[model samples]
Target chain A: MKKILIVATIFFNINLLFAQSSIPSVDVKDINGNIFNTSQISNDGKPIIIDFWSTSCKPCIKELIAIDENYEDWKEETGVKVYAVSIDNTRSVNRVAPLVNGKGWEFEILLDVNSDFKRAMNVVNIPHRFLLDGNGKVVWQHTSYAEGDEEELYELVKKLAAGESLEEKH
Target chain B: MKKIILLFTILAFTFSSLQSQNADLGQIHGNFQMDAQLYNNDSLIGANVPSEKMGLNSYANFNYTRGKFNAGIRYEGYFPALNGFDAKNNGVGIPYKYASYTSEDLTVTVGNFYEQFGNGLVLRVYEDKALDYDYALEGVKLNYKPYKGVYIKAVYGKQRYYWNTGTGLVRGIDGEFAINDIIEKLADKKTKLTLGGSFVSKYQADKDPIYKLPENVGASAARINLYRGKFSLTGEYAYKINDPSGVNDKIYKPGEALIVNATYSQKGLGIYASAKRVDNMSFQSDRNADGKDLNINSLPDITKTHSYALLAMYPYAIQPNGEIGFQAEVIYKIKKKSLLGGKYGTTIDVNYSRVHNIQETQINDTIAIGESGSLGYNSNFFEFSKEVFFSDLNIEISRKFNKKVKATVVYQNLVFNNSVFNNGNYHKTIYSDVAIADITYKFTSRKALRTEMQWLRTNQDKGEWGMLMLEYSMPHWFFSVWDMYNYGNPEENKQVHYYYGAVGYINKANRIQIGYGRQREGVICAGGVCRYVPASNGLSVSITSSF
Candidate 1:
């Protein structure tokens, strides 16, 4: 069984090369304590960036701040939207609202205390990011972030906003 | 031999079978990871060289979903297990597999599943790969949303014990209701209210020949939440019947716990505070299992989880036997262009927490308190023992100096009772003051350099220490080096330096990192669970990806 799973891993990787998947519908919570569905996440026919973060994850905080520093300009220029998702469990779930409010980040915040949405996205680590086009189709994704990785991400966002995404052309 | 050949043949067949499907049929997705290490000897650090000379651990999960039906399986493989991992994990098998169906507001699942109720006082099923902890229940689960604001769930299963399942039978039911969502008149009100409750029970056959034990144990918890304007408050209380397990010294003591927290958050500032009390709250599926097996509940600690390497060395371990604690924190952002805030802005964070043993008294003078087969001891709910377990005071300030530079400074004071962990050494308390300076310089839009300087001053245990780290990162690649020096050892020749270097590459959802270094022996924790890593010198490689 283990050997078969190895081959399955390779097979899935290969199959994903030509795959285009939309977001999965999973139950999560908004900052207001409302149960929201992931399928409702949209940017009014514009680009969207979904970020997974936690309070204890330093790199996740860095990446969010790095983007927040220029979020206004990015939103005004491209009409792009960013959704910061907190994966803090019950131990720190209450801290999410306060920290986000204190930081004054101008983005939607969702709480995934049970990690349901994270498991649906096949995300294994924090600082994981996903870029979706106007059609709600995932165009690009990354698992880890360095100090300057946001620059590369912004370039992708620019290309995507210009109607250069593969799905958009189709 | 023949078994290997058979497995490979099946692998190829399964791959082709899956590849033949068209995109319109359904969706397939999952992730995979592999970690391998090469070990070496180092006497100074007391590193041990295993006979295998190497270790390899890997696993993969595949899930298929089509409309309302979903299914998945996970396979794990270990080559004689890692140095610190349990020997029982040396085999290969599929320990997790499940299928579920959902229609409208109702869903049903069979096989392995993870869950948690309220504050997890009565039940919680979870897994942490880094900590080698998974209590996934193999059973049947049901979830239903009968009304607008009403939700209910029920579970019946046995706990997963490594490759097999525990013999005990466990069952639970949980229900939650949102008053604002259900009521038409209060829907638009600013004040919101929610209430929840859970009941969990376990049954094990009594096979002990010496003393009669309870064949059935039950526990329950109740929770409430209120939100108004910028303030929110939550409270949860849990209780358990008499459960004389291996961890509680065979005392027939009922368990109970209470947790309460309040938060006031608004634009530019946030404040949070909470307190908790636990007494004899150890509930496990197996009466004789010790350590991390078959645990049915987890306690939340009133402390912060630090990410800094040095600061994480002395984390507080939650005491399930009995404990009392409180925590408070404030986050404030200095306005931009202010005297203290640069052109951008400054963020200040202050956090403090302390924990201690609960006060306990004898039932009577005739019998010594906590005697075997007795009702244990009595305690005042509002009192705490003089012996302090842990305390921490920390503050952090972050600011962007300019367009090309950013900096953060942190200072902390910590006190840890090492005696609890040192087999009652009596006077092994450790007190330390830590300071750290972190700076990042952006050379270009796609390139950056980061550095950190950390110092820890102490007069106990291993004494003072210093650490330095440097990293250079590009758009897709990164290189980093770090070193930790124990410079103030009581014994002159025992002082040593631990260093490590790594190079990693990241492209989209795929990553590979290679490193060679010396690992320090310490405890790594997530939530309330923890794992101990032994000191070793070695080279390691890891690869991970998701699709």
Candidate 2:
């Protein structure tokens, strides 16, 4: 009986909390090893896309490559900025810079070496994406990726850029 | 129970008041994961028959955040545990909970937490659910940033072992300083420098009958990193005081480890190299704990992590006691429309890694190498013994034939010493060659088909093996089937086929997968950490979701 009550209380709390939500503040490092808070990622009325990835995840690489191939067009269309966050631990962190340089990806890359930001975002898998509005409010989120999944992300970015509310559609 | 209810009611009322004020009360977010398997006895492959016949592992995390305050609790359930997991993890409860608050320059956490220092050579407390390994510390942690570039962290706790705390106390402190940011003058320079150091100590009362042991053992490490333009270099060294443990056969020899890595990259080419050596450096929280439990420090595995089935069969496991190894890799992209490059250009990746035992000399003519109650052996820090432990050389080429199709081919040569993995019974080294071809074709914008064909040839252990996998994926659904056959086993009856099939559905942040398969016994490794997987015929279901 006590267990049931505790579980019920948790669910009630979750319901109340989910009604008011925003992107949590977490510290991450850029490619140059400087710390910056996630709350400071706001743009001047432009949408931002954050992609969580790792060097070992194939789907993540595919998604990033696809987005990179069309990043210029996306930026031009929606005035959007993309941040590619790598959750590579120390074992593979050394390869991240070289890998990014070799691939010639133009998006800003951030390193979450210990996965602190990942846990704060409640991300369970790689290739996860979060779409934040111009105000730095998380509007939409998606996980996993198949071929051509980048199109959906771009569509949402375009919508967010047009001052459309994602609370209804998403 | 009444007090609990009253407290929850008060919290709920407070949140309601905040909601009415139109303030950003807080956010509650978490993830849920469940894996369940139903097994069938298979004596042919030496699979153990479980009386329960079914196992389930599940966890749900709940996190609440309001301004600078955050709290979380995780409920874990392991009914009968999994086949490969330790039997002690057969029950379930809320083993992890924490509350933390962050001010402008300081943060404090109470309850359970995970931490790592430097390259995790001196201390690391983490959890890996896949391996049923959870060593989160239950205590208090503090983080303070005194200056713009100086950060210090300290923690004191007892490690969680299954549902209980280990019989030891651990305390650690670490500090990191960014030299460029600290001095302010070098901040605008092109080169970056960072220095860090950590000290960790574990206390476990000595209760042995034979040899006298130190109740407290300490380890310390220092690291430095430098980065300029397209080049970066990092090095870390650690030292531990003499402490007898099970992994080292109760030897009293002190431990030491050193790791160095460097990388240089350009637009189309990247090169990376790393070297590591460890001597008697197995630091666990408990002196008698074995397997993957109570590990307080982790050694970084410099070898490449393989994802392909056949390529991963002979994965290397880091020998924490004594090993010297190095790895080098190069990735190059051929220019498009060049002689060697096609329309879409080609990517070439080559990697090589090798590990050998550290040079060891007997302390004296009277005592054998690595004997208990003695210094064990004297090792030359820079010298490598002739005894090869493991080596691998692999190359891969990927190309796009058209806009709708892409393919990759890989070949690898591996030399594995079985004596290190298996007790000493299998002392012979096995050499194997592997080949793999992976291709994916897109039928439409939302439809795709991918296939993999792999083969391995070897004369030792299980001899030769072949595998084929096909996967079809759509926007919302995916289906896959795979089969692995051991065809060249010396005993005809030993040759068997392991087949598996799975279907998955994905909706936003949620995914569900169901698979039924016959598994073959093998050692599964990730980041040089390994666990033995038992053969079983079973149906498995997995689900994960986040909000």
Candidate 1 local lDDT, residue B293: 84
User: What lDDT does candidate 2 reach at residue B420?
Assistant: 81
Q: TM-score: which candidate is best?
A: 2
**Predicted candidate 2 versus true structure: per-residue lDDT over B1-547, tens digit per residue:** 8889777777777777877887776788899999999998778787666788898888998899999999999999988887898889889899999999999899999999988887889888877777677889999999889998998999999999999999989999999898998998998999999999999999999999999999999999999988898888999999999989888988999999999999998887889999999999998889999857888888888888888889989788889989999999998888778878788678888999999999999999999999988889999998999999999999989887777998999999999988987767787999999999999999987789999999999999899999999999898799999999999888889899889999999988899999998988877876788888899888999998988
RMSD for each of the candidates: 4.6, 3.6
> Could you report the DockQ of all the candidates, in the order they appear?
0.41, 0.44
User: What is the per-residue lDDT of model 1 for residues B1-547, given as tens digits with 9 covering 90 to 100?
Assistant: 5565566567655655665664344577888888888999998877788899988888888887776787889889888677777777788989999999989999899999888887788988877677787788999999889999888989999998889988888899999888999998999999999899999999999887776888999999999988998999988999999888788877888999999989998888999999999999988999888658888887877788888887877888888888899999999999999998879899999999999989988888876777777888998897888878989999999999988899999999999998865447657789999999999999986688889999999999888889999989887788989998888878777687889999999888989899989888878877656777888889988888887
Candidate 1 local lDDT, A56-92, one digit each (tens): 8999999999899889999998899999999998878
Give the docking tier of candidate 1. Answer: acceptable
Interface RMSD in angstroms for candidate 2: 4.7
| Residue pairs that clash (backbone atoms under 3 angstroms), model 1 | none
Task: Kindly give the stretch of ten consecutive residues in candidate 2 chain B with the minimal lDDT sum.
Answer: B41-50
